[model samples]
Target: MRVDDFCDYDNSFPDEFYACLPRECPDCGAPMEMSEALTQLHCSNPKCPSKVVQRMVAMAADLGVKDLGEARATKLVSEFGLDNPLLLFSYEPDKDGVPEGMSFDVANGIVSQLNAKRRMTLAEYVKLAHLPFIQTSSQALFGGYDTLDEAYAALEEGGLGYVCRKLDISADSDVSVRAARVYETLKMFKSDLYQCIDFVEIIKMHSAEMVHLTAVCSDEVGFPFKTKADFYATVNNLYQNLHVEFLGALTRNCDYLVWAGADGSPARLTNKVKKARAYNEKYEEHKASGTLKEGEHEIKIVSAKQFLYILEQLVK
Candidate 1:
């Protein structure tokens, strides 16, 4: 039987199997610990050479810097004595010597690629930082804040409990543990990390004024307006005080979905309508279960006439 199958069936490994396994990491001589799920053993030392090289390669890829594979990353780490992956951003081709056997052109090219990606969105920076269990879509963590310092302040002030409450994550969930770990990691290294990058800006998709009251004007026929531009012009001219922002596409943040079709007797269900309805149905379920988070607004489908009337009432 296979070793995996034997382990699954027996629920314990043979004494010989345990004896054969290394108690310490072979590369760094650090203690080896089982992963949280007990799936595999890993080096306890975060500063292990192997780990540093792997992190550099991963960070390069995450930051959209090309050609910095394992081989190149290993050489850079060894040649420059890089302690952290973030140090890769501070590489200066003119000041720092290129790794032996690597041409100046190649080194310059890599530096140029890194320079090109200096400015990044907060979500992208989080992914590049390789925070534990955090994905590229870190909007849940950094959405409301405009700057990293603001988000970090919130994290520090609220602690893990605040993060759990903000994200609607259960305190006992694995995600909460990961969130805490991420918070600790950020606290320890956020300054160094932020200093390495040129710019880290949070791009808010919807403004606070329009976040809960935004609408999308679909391009379906039968509306009184000739084009979307005409509709926008009329709305801006008449409802200037309402501050109603119109989107070109349906998004989860959108509050109102206005189409050209008549209410109750619709001509066709366009993709925008379908998406809006799907979002509404999902939010309705969340609302029923009382699991809806703040800003989780439902989309209200309305005809062009109803949209104008709603705006008029709001303006009044």
Candidate 2:
């Protein structure tokens, strides 16, 4: 009983339906992809009015710009014609175009607040990438990734391309496109952001266990492990890029002191080996004497392959 089945069907419905269909974005013209039902349409275009506000909210949080909510961002765009988030730093307010029932000075204060927070540390800025490559939901970005400078090198060396290809997200994909916009927005304020970043700071884990890797058993025939560097690299791999900082001298705060080969052929003891032996001797004495301090972890000593075996159980 539908009009499409009739012989003299009217084509007006098709034209009206096409005109009113919410299939594409109003601002950027990208197709609207809904989660479940087609009863509503949300813009995936990063530059679109709605999506821009969402990014602004996240960017504001990253920059520590308080009191600037999504509603305020939307109002600034829809009412005052201020669309780009970076424009807030230099937004000039006048007698008109302010939100309804809000004074121009109050609006100006909001802009001032955002401008005040334009500067953030390089660590804070890099964390805003929210890329698929790094785990975003934890402190792993700073603790697990290499030094900030080295991490930047990895990013420049096709890390981003790797993520895009792995996810099958072309450079033009919506989320990737939005990530590009976020990058540009930060770039616009790069000078200020860089001013606040401490170039010499190095991020590390909470308290890493240190060990010694001697070349004593490195070249021994029939040995499972190869060289000292190979041993160091294996332990470093377990930590996922955190340097082991092999104890070459006395360290006051060492958590572990693994002997390269406790049962190997006799070898000369350097200052580092002497320190490890002395520390463990004292540790064993204190433990037997029942004088071990509360909340203190005893230093451990194991062979090269034994250390690797212990780490193998923990790496995953």
Candidate 3:
């Protein structure tokens, strides 16, 4: 069976069963190569539209550029000739863009989204590179190391040593392999220096088993708005303030449900806070009943600002 098939019955594969087969990409009919280690293979042709689209998909997804789906990405290249992610965000005076059939406003809107995405945190950009084994969840994996001066430090501290130490698993284990891949990918990205992009977007993904965000800029102290006009913004800011994405909080699997609000008031609780409280309750129940595993996140709600202050003290 192929690597993708992945041991229908066994996790380990015998050496004799492995062999490269002559293959052609069904999408572009180009010759494809597969490493014994990799589960999936793609067309060898870099210009292949299908191959490009998936890369685009990875970039857009990591950058959080909404609505640039595979269908749209494919159309952007095959139909409109906008083949590059940078180009997707950019527009020329002559090209009436966006996959032929889409309206002018829609095309402009897509470009607008792309422009907005240009400004992002370094973690998000690294995630966008779509490097092998660097899943969104692994963003938190970097936090385990304490001495790395730069992200590239993961290649040193967070690589094998990190795996063996924090994970308490072999450095060569599959899980460690994933961490090692992140280190390798970061090195590869660093080779192409980026000067204009803001490195301040570089936010630390804190090491936690469980974390729940809570904050709502209500009528009280909420900035730039009156009467909770931006409740969602409050919840989002909590994530951003932590230098963690909304999804990153989940990935770190924070054990604490840090509640940030004006007096933990119900009226101030956004949907995120409410949901977190509910989830925390479930976690408590499961833990009490002994259904939760050792590594499973323990849930507790700490004061919001205080919660962050702790991170400030620890991370800084």
C-alpha local distance difference test of each model: 0.68, 0.49, 0.49
- Which segments of model 2 are wrong by more than 4 Å? 1-21, 26-28, 35-41, 61-66, 79-87, 90-102, 126-153, 160-316
Mind sharing the TM-score for model 1?
0.58
TM-score: which is higher, 1 or 2? 1
The TM-score of candidate 2 is 0.37
**TM-scores for all predictions:** 0.58, 0.37, 0.48
Candidate 3 residue pairs in clash (backbone atoms < 3 Å): 209-253, 209-254, 210-253, 210-254, 210-255, 211-254
Which of candidates 1 and 2 is the stronger one according to lDDT?
A: 1
Q: 1 or 3, which is superior by lDDT? A: 1
lDDT tens per residue, model 2, 227-295: 453344334445432334443344536654555445564544455566666766777788899988764
Q: Give me the overall lDDT of model 2.
A: 0.49
How big is the positional error of residue 177 in model 1, measured in Å on the Cα after superposition?
2.6
Cα displacement (Å) at residue 82, model 1: 2.0
lDDT of 1 by residue, 1-316 (tens): 2233333455476768765656678877877766546567777776677777898888776554667899998899888877677787778878988999888898898887665555444554666666545553255776665467777888888998877776677899777876676666667667756776553332343344432257886665346755564454345445324444566688999878877664764557789988988998999999999999888988988877788888778756
